[model samples]
Target: MEPGKLLENSELGLRILAGENGLNRKIRNEDVNRPGLALAGFYRNFAHDRLQVFGQGEFAYLLDCGGEVEGRIKDEFFSYEYPALVFTHGNQPPSCFIKKSNETDTPLLQTTLSTHDFILNFNRIITRALAPQTSIHGVLIEVFGLGVLLLGPSGIGKSETALELIERGHRLVADDMVHIRHMGKGELIGESDPMIEHHMELRGIGIVNIKDLFGVGAIRKKVQVDLVVFLEDWKEDKEYDRLGIDEQTMEILDVSIPSITLPLRPGRNIPILVETASMNHRSRRMGFHAARSLSERIHSRISQQITEDAERENPPKKERKKASPKPLMGPV
Candidate 1:
């Protein structure tokens, strides 16, 4: 990430106070440092690679220090090649510090946000900016709150199914090309190409903007991919899973995402199937596997039937009748 890119983002509320020459400097670290210890002349463990931040305490400390002491601290701080310096809570750096930053070609930035809020936002922005990314040909949509990626060869009804889903109130994330970023911990975020976002191509019709045709509610900027569905032409001899007892997955960017293959055939509603798959995937995630539950119930019933048959074959012995006492009582 570059300081200029951070400046461009309105959410961060950052502005260049000095050292515009260092706008192109790259920020390799996804973290920021307070540099409190370094300001107090302790630089043993100072992290020079991160963006140095000056919060309320650090700014006040600089203001209270004598001219000579402040100059000494500024010289020592700029000696290291830190990427940039940020002042939070609208605090401004001292003149000597700003001058040193310009002399060292280090970026000096200021934001009105509080220290905690600034750090939180910066971390999120930097993490996404530095995450591993890749692009694939597919349609991404949010069905029942789960992000589903529709995969298949071109002209296999991927766009048409997405259009039907959109008409059914499901939001479309990307069409034709999906740009995916791998946020660590088995998470992948996907978005559409900027030029073609919210637009879909039909076999008969040309490009059409989904948002313009169906309204903004039918579109989404991005979504996390939770399930991958591959659609292929139905084969006469191919066998498909009738009871979803075996789970399947698709690997994207080294992350394993739950996936299923649907054979396309006449009279099969692909959109409805996709919706059901999305819901089923969500249920499985919540620990309720419908297929496994049904299988277990069937096994239990069979075991019970076997026990009943065995008991009937070898019945318990009947107690012998005591006939002599009963006969004497009857005769009297």
Candidate 2:
């Protein structure tokens, strides 16, 4: 799913938040989970669905499933309760009502938005919602059993490179923002934010659609990462590896992922490099360490030459006295 499309799907929610036409209903559950916001009640009512709100001295909320609950209003009694309520639930009609409740001496303000409008605004709020005060942006790609994450300074062609990989018959696990969940045994699963899957923002181009461009097979919703690829600007003076001896690593959510630093220079085919890196990584995992093998071969040759040199310097002493001593002992 493209970010734009995700935004489009959530347009109703956005509109509802922006005071669009959606259902206005009260919270029916005694506990609503907005720990930071401190909103009360778990039950949210959708106006489109068959919902009946009964309020005389207290309030009772009824749902289509015959699930009815009686509870006292709490939290933001002045603000949220002041204006009826907006229901952002999907596939439900929008409805609202306001009348004199005994608890509040002031008359309640009953207002409602259309169900269609609530859905439009709901999506907007979800995509733009903050990440629990602890979140960062980056792209993660999984290839050849190697979870190589592409990281760099913003606009450094992270998404652009990923787009190329997808075109070259690779899968895209996540883009822009990845949600890394730690499943037990030191394993991490990388998933794209629901609202921004399969979307990349190109500098010259506004937003290129990945699935549409490369077909449905090019995009993936989630994947387990095996390596990280860090792209850097090419520097003339900086030294780079001519031999594949050094390995690198990167950390995400406290999990370490093998990293490779590749320079972005003109005429350099990065997509090919990335693919080769992934294949090399896979090769190493199958008990074939190229660097170690090379080192061992060099050491064995050096040891053999030292042995030959030591033999040349000190030849083996001849056993001249042994045969004569054995004959003399037999005669005695």
Candidate 3:
């Protein structure tokens, strides 16, 4: 992110205080730093790569050190080529500090938001802006609170299935094209393209605005992708997963997403299957796996039946041998 971008974003409430010439400086660090120590003549291990933040404590410390001490501190602090300096809670820097910033060509910014709120919003924005992204040709929908991405050939009913899912009260995120981002720690977020957001292209109907037709409740800005569904034409020679015991996954931006392949037939209910798959995915996340549970029960029953059959085939020898030994000990 550049300081100019931060200034352009009105939601962040950041405005230029001084050093407008340094707006193009790149901000490499996602985190901001408090320069209280650097302001107190301690520069060792100073984080000069991040945005320097002057919160209440730092401002108060500067006020305490009047005259020469403050001026020297400001000079030493701005000596490094840090990205920018931000004053939170509407705290304006002193005229000397602004002059120093201008002399050094370091951007100086100010925000009216409290220190905590500004950091929260700033981190959220920076994380998103710097995240790795990719695009996929698929339909994204939110079913049962799980984000589902539909993939397959162009004419494989992906759009139609998404339409049916929308009518069933699920929310449509994207259609035809999806922009995905890798949010660190094994998570993928999916959203629609800016030009085609909340719009779907049906075969005969052309383009339709889902939100305009179904109200705002039927669409979402973005969602975390939890499942991927592939729609393929039915083939007599192909075998699909029926038991669902062997799970499948599709990798998007190096993150593994649970996936399933469904064969399209004349009478198949694709919408319902998608819904069930979404619910099952959620259930599995919560540690309840239906197929695995059933498989375990079947195996246990088969093992018990085998034990009964073995017992019947060869019964334990009765106590007749013990009685013969007792008789021999007593009288032949």
Candidate 2 residue-wise lDDT at 75: 20
RMSD of each: 3.4, 11.4, 3.0
Query: The CA-based lDDT of model 1 is what?
Result: 0.92
Candidates' lDDT values, in order?
0.92, 0.55, 0.91
Q: How close is candidate 1 to the true structure, as a TM-score?
A: 0.93
- TM-score order, best first, reads 3, 1, 2
Q: Which ten-residue region of model 3 has the weakest summed lDDT?
A: 320-329
All candidates: TM-score: 0.93, 0.56, 0.93
If both were scored by TM-score, which would come out higher, candidate 2 or candidate 3?
3
Best by lDDT: 1
Looking at model 1, report the run of 10 residues with the lowest lDDT sum.
323-332
- Model 3, residue 183: C-alpha shift (Å): 2.2
Off by over 4 Å in 3: 321-332
lDDT of 2 by residue, 1-332 (tens): 11122224433332222222222332232211211112234344422122122222122132321212112233233223322233333222212222222233222222233444443443334323422222346777766545667878897788888878877778877777777765535566677777777777788887777888888887777676788788889989998876667676676667777778899988988989999988988888787878878988999999999999999999999887654344535554
lDDT of 3 at 312: 100
Give one digit per residue, the lDDT tens place, for model 3 in 182-238: 879988889999999989999988999999999999999999999999999999999
